[model samples]
Target: MNVSLILIILLVGAFATYLAGDKLASKVALLFSIASLGFSIVLLNQYNLGENINFINQWINQPNVSFALNADGLAIAMLLLTTALTPIIIYSSFRNEYKNAKSFYALILFMAFAMCGTFLAADGLLYYIFWELALIPIYFIALIWGNGDVEERKKAVVKFFIYTLAGSLFMLVAFIYLYQKAGSFLIQDLYNLNLTASEQLWIFLAFFLAYAIKIPIIPFHTWQANVYQKAPTVGTMLLSGIMLKMGLYSVIRWQLPIAPLAAKEYMYIFIGLGIAGVIYGSIVALRQRDLKKLLAYSSLAHVGLIAAGSYTLTIDGLRGAVLQMIAHGFVVVGLFFASEIIYRRYETRVIAEMGGIRSQAVKFASLFMILVLASVALPTTFNFVGEFTVLYSLSQINVWFAVLGGTTIILGAYYMLKMYQHVMLGETNTKPFADVTFNEATTLVIIVAVLFFFGMYPKPITDLITPSLENIITQINRIN
Candidate 1:
C-alpha cells in the first residue's frame, strides 16, 4: 500500500540523516519531513476513493501476529497531524544546535516512523508493538540532548518512560485475552468479540490505564510538567503535539468499540476524571511562574476537555475530540516554541524575569498574542470551534458537565492572558529581547494560517471526520 512507502521514506530518511553527518543532518531531516508531509497529503486525497491501503504480512508465528498497516480516515487524520508537525518541529530546531546532530535528527525521524505505524497498524498485536516502539527515541532525545541538569532530566525522563511503559503492560494483558477469545489479532476480529460486561469492565480498565497515563489524566500526570520543562523544545513539541494524541486516538480506535458495554456503563467516570483534570490543570496553571510548566498545565487542561469529549461517545463528542486534538497540536506547539524563543533570547523561562518584550519585538509579541488567545479559545480562532463543539456535546449529556469543563474558558483566559501581560506587555526589561528570526517566523506563520483558516472555515475537517465517527457510533451502539 502507499502508506507503507510513507513509513519507508521516514525509516530510510532517519538513517540517511545519520549518515549525512552533523554538517548536513538538520537540512536533510527537514527535506525528508517535508517530503513525508507531501506523501501524507497524497494519502489524504486517495482516502475518499476507498482505496485499499492495508498491507498484511507474516511477522510472528506463535502470537499469530502480522505486519498490517491500514489508512482509514481516522488513521489518515492522525498521520496528517504527525507529518505536518514534523517539518515544523525540525525547522524550529534549526535555530538550536545539538551535539550528535545526526543521531538527534535521526531519532526524530524514527519517532515519526513509529508514530505513523501506531496510527496505521490494523492488527492489535502490530499496533501494540508500534505503540511501544514510539516511546524509545523521545526517551533518548530528552535524556541526552535535553536541557536542565542531567541528573534531574534523567529522573524526569525515566519517570515519564516508566510510567507510560508500566501502564502499557495492562493493555498487553487485555490484548492477550482478546487474542485467546478471537483467535486473531486483527482489529476487526477483536471488535467482533462478544465480551460479557465483566470482561468488558476489566478490559476497559486495562485500556484506560494505558490511554489515561499517556494523556496524563489528573492523577496520572505527575511526570508531565517536569518532562515538558526539562526536555528540549523539539522533544516537547513532539510529546505534546503528536504523542499525547496517540492516547486519545487509542480510545477512539480500540478502547471504545472493543469494550462498548463498559464504555457506555462507565462513561460518567471517564467524563468526571477528564473534567477534574480540566479544573485542576487550570487552577494550578494560574499560579505557575515558569513559562514552560504553565504551558504544560495548559496542555493538560486542553486535552482534559478533549478526553471528556471522547467519553461522551456521541458523534458530536468524538468529532469534537479529534478536531480539538488537531487544533491543540498546532496551538500547543506554537505556544511551546514561543517559550523556546523567549528562553533563547532572554536566557530565562521565569515569568517575572521576563517583561516588556513587545516594546522591542513587536512582531514576535503580536504572533505570540494570537497563539495565547487561540489557546484561550477566543472566538474566530480554531480552538474556539473545537471548544464550542465539545462543550455543546457535553451539555447534551448533562448541563453540569458542560459547566465544569467550561471553566477553562474563564481560567484559560486568566492564566494565558496573565502570562502574556507579564511576558510581553509590562514595562521594558533591561535584557535585550530580539524579534523572531526568519525560520521561526515561517513556522509560526504556518501554524497561525492553519488555525485561522480552519477557524473561519471548518467545514472540510468536519466533513472528513464526521462520517467515520458516525460509523464508530453505529458499531458501538449495535454492539451494546
Candidate 2:
C-alpha cells in the first residue's frame, strides 16, 4: 500500500475509534497506532537505504503552494520516534479511567496525524499549517484532562497557546515574505532565493521567535513549567517527547539555511541566550520541588545547548543537536513516566512528600535511577553520545563556550540526584509503595533498551543524518 494511503487510513481510524464507545476505544486506538508504526517501518524500508522520499503535486500554482510531502533520513527518524512512542503512551494509560475515553484516544491519534504531517511537509505553507494543527489537540488535552486546579490548568493552557501562536504568526509573515521573494513555497526554492542581509535578518528574527517560543528558551519559557505541571502524564509525554523536538528540528531545517549569513552574524546572540537558558534553567530547576517542573527546566537547559550547537553551523554541532533531540525525547519521557508511577503511588508530585521507595520497590527505584543517569548523560546512555558530540562541536567554536555549555551536565547531576535522593531514598516515612506492574516495567525496559542501544551503536543514526547534514553544510558554505 502507498504511504500516503496509510497516513489517511490512520487519520480515519482515529475518528472511527472516537465514534466507538469507551469499552473499545482504547483497543482500537492501540491497533491503529501499531498499524501506523508498521507502515512507518515499511516507509523506512522503501527508502533507498540512504535516500529521501518526496511526493509532490500542484496545490496552488500562483502563490506557489503544493501538496508536498517529503521524508529524508531526519524526517524518517522523527517519524519512527513518533510512531514508536504512541503505542507506548497508549499502553501506559491503560490503567487509567478517563472521563471521555473515546475523545481522549481520538485526540492522541489526531496528534499523531499532525506530527507526521509536520515532519513530512515540504512546502513552507503546508509545513506551517501542519505545525499549527499539531498545537490545538494538545491544548484541549491539557486543558480538559490535566492535573491541578481547574483555574491553574486553564491558565497554563492559555499561556502556552498564546505564546506559541504569537511566535508562529510572525513565522507565517516571514514565510509570506519569502514567498514574495522566491515566488514559490517549496523549501528548495526558498533556499535558492537570494535576499539582502537586512532582509535575512528580519526573516531570521521572525523564524527565531516561532521556534524559540516552541523550544521555550529563556525569557520565553515561562509557560512550560506550568504546562508540564498541569498536563496529564500522556499529554506531558507528548509535549516533551515529540512537540519540543519540532522547534529544534525547525531551527536546523528552516532557520539556518534560509538565512545562513544572518545566522552567522547573529550566532553570538543565540549562543548567549543558549548559555543563559542553561544557567537560568539549571538554577531554577535546583529550586523546583515538583518533579515535573524540574524535568521541564532540565529540558530547557538541554534544548539550549541544542540551539547553541545549531548556530555553530558545523557538521558535528548539527548532528549532535539532532542526536540529542532524539536522546532527550526518550530520556524525558521515561523520566516523566517514572514521575507518573510515583504520583500514582503517593498521590503527590512534591519531591519532599515521599521517601524509602528504593527498599520497598527495588525495580521502580532501579528504573528511576537508570533514567536519572541517562538524564545526566552517563556513559553508555544515548544522552552521553549526543552531549559529547555537541560539546566537542562547541569546543571547536570556542573552548569557553564548550565549558559554559558543559556546566549543564554538572548542574543536571546536582538537581537530578537531589531529586532522586529526596524521592527514592531515606527512611520509610510514608506507606509502602507498590512495585511496578508488569506493563509499566515492560514500558520502561523498552525505553532503556533503546537508550542503551542507540548509545552503544550510534552509527546507524549518525549515518542517517550525515548525508543531509553534508547537504546543509554545503549550502551554508556556498551562501557564506
- Give TM-scores for every candidate, taking all chains together and pairing residue i with residue i: 0.99, 0.98
Worst 10 residues of 2 by lDDT: 1-10
> Model 1 clash pairs?
none
The TM-score leader among the candidates is 1
For each candidate in the order shown, give its overall lDDT on alpha carbons.
0.93, 0.89
lDDT of 1: 0.93
lDDT of 2 by residue, 1-480 (tens): 344655685698789889998889999999999889998888888774544456888998787789888778888788888888888898888877899999999999999888888888889999999999999989999999999999989998999999999999999999999998888899999889888889989999999999999987878888998999999999999999999889888888888889998988888889879888888889999999888999989988988988888888999999999999999989898999999998888888888888999989999999999999999999999999999999999899889989999999999999999999999899775576999999899989999999999999999889877888888888777743
Weakest ten-residue segment in model 1 by summed lDDT: 45-54
Best by lDDT: 1
List the candidate 1 regions with Cα displacement exceeding 4 Å. Answer: none
Q: Write the per-residue lDDT of candidate 1 for residues 100-172, one digit (tens) a residue.
A: 9999999999999999999999899889988999999999999998888999999999999999999999999
TM-score of 2: 0.98
| True lDDT of residue 217, candidate 1 | 91
